[model samples]
Target: MQKGGPPPGRSSTTRRASPRCSAGTSRLRRVCQLRGLASAVGSCSSPASKRPCRGRPESLACRRHGRSSVDGRHRGCMEPPATVGHVLALYPLDRPRAVGAFDASTRNDNLRVVDAGGRQFVLRRYRRNRDPERVRFQVRFQRHLEAYRFPSASAVEARTADPVVVDEEGFPWTLFEFVDGEHFDFSRPEQAREAGRRLAEFHDVADRFVGAATASLLEDDVRRFVATPRAVVDELRDAFGIPSLELELQNFRRRLETIAASLHPERLDALPAGWLHNDYHGRNMLFRDDAMVALLDFDKLERGPRASDIVRGVLSFARERRGSRVLRPVFARGFLAGYRERRGISAEELAAMPALAELAFAPYAAICRMLQADHQDPVAHILGDLQGMRETEAQCAALRQILV
Candidate 1:
């Protein structure tokens, strides 16, 4: 819905997509495969037609809890091809044609992938509530990472050379050079080590890039999770039709409080504090074989206790999904080994790993609770994440062994 020309500091291009181009077809097909809808791609009509593609398809990328039917009941709404072409026309590129575009969005932000000149770039239409200043900080952070030769997306500067641009629709959009790699596969121990090593590198860079714009350590999240009222949990259970959800909620509250109490903030106050990729997880990374080719997403970037960042990654990359509902420890040893190879963890930080690992469980619980009231996707897919965290004794023991 971006309406106008380039922002104040940018130049503008106006080349548009051809009404019907063979190049468009190839792009569309690739996008379909990426979205895990090869079947739907077969019957997709022309972009000029403004018709919806028909198929019952789902995406493992977003891992959204929605059912896709022929009736258009589920799935994020796909953007029109012309709209995509229009957006691309604004940016300076050798080939302005938008061969194919797909909605690679999340619950809050809108992301569309546009293939041009045999390369991919992401156009992110940030949520209305997202702070522009913070987003600019993220843009600078990525540039800093790239400057240090870190594998990260390059934010395409506008004509004015500014990394971010405001579209005519008053929404902020930024284009990032796409990295061609797969999400981190935990089954590969080497990949786990590579991820850990790269993460240490990222931390090293972030440690020096401190500023007043960045918020302080990650206390708000812990406080918010602990403060999740029992009343809210009771209502969530009833709305989601879960019978014993309240009891589960009660248990989470107690455990989170215990962890918070045991891991005092003052002990980690002297630990490295700087900008952090608070949501460092597998889905945000790209791997070419066992090596990490790109690290993605920085929307939640903020100054935080550094060890908590590692703990967050361990919870994400080291856990293995068993069956449909359980996430067990299988890779933490390799991950910790790799991390310690590059960065030093203090005694205080090592002691707090177990607690921070417990704290990491809150987001899964919080996300499931928020989605419980929605009738959209099946709640099981989201709530099932919580089930994986229940095997805590084993996970805590695994963490102790790694930190010891």
Candidate 2:
């Protein structure tokens, strides 16, 4: 077990039921936000004590596998009052006074837990996108990271010796030792630089883990890139009648094709590859004193060329919080400079980066929103991607100039 983590064995404390709190998830969030007042919140008593805990029995948001029992589980929407019945009953931890969201963890899947003994934990639920095979694959990689002492939020196993717990709703969940840190402050070039170094270290571990399997993973990446643009266009045209769409799309489509043309499968396949933390942006990392402490949300973890992660990381680190624009050469320089401290990149990889720029700037969220077909001008959503086109071009130029 990771140090300071809850014990993995079954709890002798019998399952205690609690009444649904009127405020539900929010009240727990409110109460747990202050550690000093934890005891003031209502809590579930042991079976020996008949006091009903104050909270709703809501769905525990976890990285769910749905491979276990759904019996005696909370169904429908999250009730949250049954903190003891769900979290405590499911795991071997001591009674918790309040459950809340983790720092910067806006998703429902992750929660900050503080037990009576003052032990801290993160209850991570696979509430959405719970593919069991993918969950297992990620868990295997996390364990390998732990073996390497890499600072990621690795799941602690249950008494059953499995990290994932399928609750009554058949959702998968895991508990992790609480990591202490905050999101990277973008103003600090050193943080961006440090993140680059850490990413290099992370890539080193992934390289070993992937080993002989790198070829297949790169192939998977090619298939996705080759297919996504067509799928995006087809989905839009079929659903929204693309020709009727305004002028923005004509330019957008041309730009998309140009990006596609720049990246041929043969050339793309030839580039150097490694396991990528597909979403390595600032929001997904936590830092302390400019040093990266924990890398979070490996849901998109995949194997691909190092550039897929590198180019994206540089963009994300340098992006302006107000305008969504990158900070140009300065932030990018810090990132790559620190990256070079730990790993070596070929000039070939650097050259491909300019062509990879538009591809890296994905419009997934916009495309997904347009797919709902609610808007008369559904295809208009992609105009957002065009707004940054010139800036993206400028950044690419800046990138080419930085290494020199």
Q: How accurate locally is residue 156 in candidate 1, as Cα lDDT from 0 to 100?
A: 82
Q: Please give each candidate's TM-score.
A: 0.69, 0.72
**lDDT per residue as tens, model 2, 271-304:** 8887888778877777878887778776667767
TM-score for candidate 1: 0.69
Off by over 4 Å in 2: 1-79, 83-85, 103-108, 210-223, 226-228, 239-250, 364-394
Count of clashing pairs, candidate 2: 23
Model 1 lDDT on a 0 to 1 scale: 0.57
- Residue 102, candidate 2: C-alpha displacement in angstroms: 3.2
**Candidate 1 minimal-lDDT segment of 10 residues:** 2-11
Candidate 1: the clashing residue pairs are: 3-169, 4-168, 9-160, 10-160, 11-159, 65-377
Q: Which digits, one per residue and each the tens of the lDDT, describe model 1 over residues 1-404?
A: 11111222211211122334345544654544444432223223356675544322333122233343332223233333333445555677765543333333343333345444566667665542235566678788887898889888888876766666664444456777766667767578788778788889999887767565544222235434434434434544555546545566667556655554666545546666666687787777788889888887776677667787888777776767423222334566677677888987788778877676655544343344334333343356435535545654456776777667
